[model samples]
Target: MQDNKIKQEIEDVELIIGKIMQIGVLIAGAVLIVGVVALLVQGDGGYAAGAHPSRPLAILAGVAAFKPYAIMMLGIFLLILTPVLRVVVSIYAFIKENDKLYAWITTVVLVILVIAMLIGYFGK
Candidate 1:
């Protein structure tokens, strides 16, 4: 009975995580579409060629300025972040299940992910 309960809980969490992924993708796709639309409205056949700020904060600033590439970059950034968020949620789920090994593993994975992102963002 206890095993069955655990299985059921895990399945439910899995379903929620699936929705999170879907929503994240949809959000990113929508943003990309908007960027395309902006390009269309500007009468440019495509995005204006130029350097887009790679840093997250800089990207946000550019998005605020309504730069098409920046909007698209923000979308791509969020798309990447979605799976990272999933991993975070999984860590919580693992802790709830009292699964120490999996929890520790997830924590390590999260740490590594953060480190990588920092390097990507802050490194030249």
Candidate 2:
């Protein structure tokens, strides 16, 4: 009974992770396509580099201002974050399984992922 329960939980986690990745990729791809189409239609496909945002929030502001580059960059950002979120789901799965060792390892991996993101954002 216990073994079957664990198996069921593992299967459920796999399903959830698969769905998460699929949705993330689809959304990112759709946004990228739209941005590309917008750029192609405009013919120039260029923006003033001086007006480009230096951070995430600023990039969001740029997107709100209808900057094509920012929109495409946001799609790229979503693509990058997809795997990071997979690690997050894995951490939860590990916790649910009561596997302390795996949970700790996943937590460390999550921390490392976050550190890398912070460095990428701020270590300029």
Candidate 3:
């Protein structure tokens, strides 16, 4: 009886995690789309002020801004798969009630993405 109760609790936790992941993916997708549209509106050139953003500092700043938006799009792409992974992990966790490895994995991927974005932005 105690084991059955534990199993039920685990399933509930997994269901909640899966739902959270789905919501996260949806939110990420929305942000990605909005960011892309904003970037596109900016055009290939500099600001609308007609200053034509020259100089190393200007270029770096421009790239830094651009990279994050681009990376967000990548996140949108990943989110599509991530939610699926989350669902699968959630199921596994429910069955086994093991360590929270999948959560950590998701966080690590996000961190790596952010770091890559920073490097792309600043390295430019």
> Hey, what RMSD does candidate 2 come out at?
1.9
lDDT of each model, Cα atoms only? 0.86, 0.85, 0.60
Off by over 4 Å in 3: 45-72, 77-81, 84-88, 91-124
- Each candidate's root-mean-square deviation in Å? 2.3, 1.9, 8.1
Worst 10 residues of 3 by lDDT: 45-54
Listed in order, each prediction's TM-score against the native is 0.87, 0.89, 0.44
lDDT of 2 by residue, 1-124 (tens): 9989998998999899999999999999988887788778775434664454557997687678767777788888889889999999999999888998999999999999999989989997
> Which of candidates 2 and 3 reaches a greater lDDT?
2
lDDT of 3 by residue, 1-124 (tens): 9889888888777677768787878876876675567657765333554343333455446546764344344545556556656655554563465556765665566667667756866785
TM-score of 1: 0.87
The C-alpha stretches of model 1 lying farther than 4 A from their native spots are 1-5, 43-48
Better of 1 and 2 by lDDT: 1
Q: Which regions of candidate 2 are displaced past 4 Å? A: 49-54
Instruction: Please tell me which predicted candidate would have the highest lDDT against the true structure.
Output: 1
lDDT-better candidate, 1 vs 3:
1
Q: Of models 1 and 3, which has the larger TM-score?
A: 1
Enumerate residue pairs that collide in model 1. none
Error of 1 at 115 (Å): 0.2
